[model samples]
Target: MRRYAEVKTANMLMAVELSRRSKGQLRSYSLHPGMVATNTVDKEALWPAFRQLDIVTSDMKPKENGFERWKTIPQGATTTVVAAFDPRLDDKAGTYLVDGNIAMKEQVASHAVDPVCCLLLE
Candidate 1:
């Protein structure tokens, strides 16, 4: 997934550059949705393992194993929807966002968006 994100970031940067060369006619952004609680993951598999990890959960909540906590699907979509439609982002093209804010801890992703990486990606 880390490698996938790195490559995806490079591609996004390339698109942003292309958009920029289009003379302000296009927009692009990279958005990260936090861990979301969805039904796609096999809850049955996670349930048995949670007990070993000392994770206690009630049956009412879905177990999303990879992260400390899970956001509802709508909650996870906040950043993506914002990136897609927010007028405030008119000047924020090529920005990498997480949770509807700039992502500051994304060293690998930042490097992927660098000019050299963008060129290679081209």
Candidate 2:
């Protein structure tokens, strides 16, 4: 899990670097898919790990949590679909998308975009 998170952060940083180097000729993005139910999400295997955290929702959407209704695999693709085709996002390259829109300012990590911290990745 630690490695997973580190790799995700690295990928986000790389997307920013790639976009910057391309100088408007290309674009890149990062996203959070939230939780999606699929074959890959083996409840049996994950149950033990999640049991420790105690926030695991049942195998149902809208499970007790008021904010999110867990999405099906197809439903989970909406953000990607929008990111790929949405004209509104054309000006928003190298940004993080959540729920089919650019995440708000506070939604982004302050240190993630810092050039000083980015140097450590090299």
Candidate 3:
């Protein structure tokens, strides 16, 4: 996803540049929903393995308590809404977001940041 993000960033930058040249006001942004109890996390292949380990080593059940410890859909939507409408973010362009705040940049996996993934973003 890193590669895809990088490419998407580039694409957003280009779009912003075009908008600027046309004397238009616009902004670009990105968001992350941290530890959201979404299908992507629950249905992942390793989730069962992780849950099995937790059963033996921890008291929490994966479905009932493990992943649910994090944010739900509404909680996750806060960041998305903030990025979309926050006046403080008006001057911020191509900002990566998480939890309604700027996300710290991190090194993405090589595969995630590859040219192929970048194209996928387009």
CA lDDT of each prediction against the hidden true structure: 0.66, 0.69, 0.56
Better of 1 and 2 by lDDT: 2
lDDT score, candidate 1, position 119: 61
Query: After best superposition, candidate 2 residue 9: deviation in angstroms?
Result: 1.1
Q: Compose the digit string of candidate 3's lDDT tens values, residues 1-122.
A: 45546775565445445434444466766556655656654445645555653421243323445433567889988988997788887776555666898655562233432344344434
Which candidate leads in lDDT?
Answer: 2
Which ranges in model 1 have alpha carbons more than 4 Å from their true place?
Answer: 43-68, 105-108
Best by TM-score: 2
Give the 10-residue window scoring lowest on summed lDDT in candidate 3. Answer: 53-62
Relative to the true structure, candidate 2 has a C-alpha RMSD (angstroms) of 3.0
Candidate 2 residue spans exceeding 4 A from truth: 43-45, 53-68, 120-122
User: Candidate 1, residues 1-122: lDDT per residue as tens digits?
Assistant: 45556677766677567656666667777767866767634467566554444333555354456355678889999999998888988876777777887667643345755656566644
Q: Estimate each model's TM-score.
A: 0.67, 0.77, 0.50
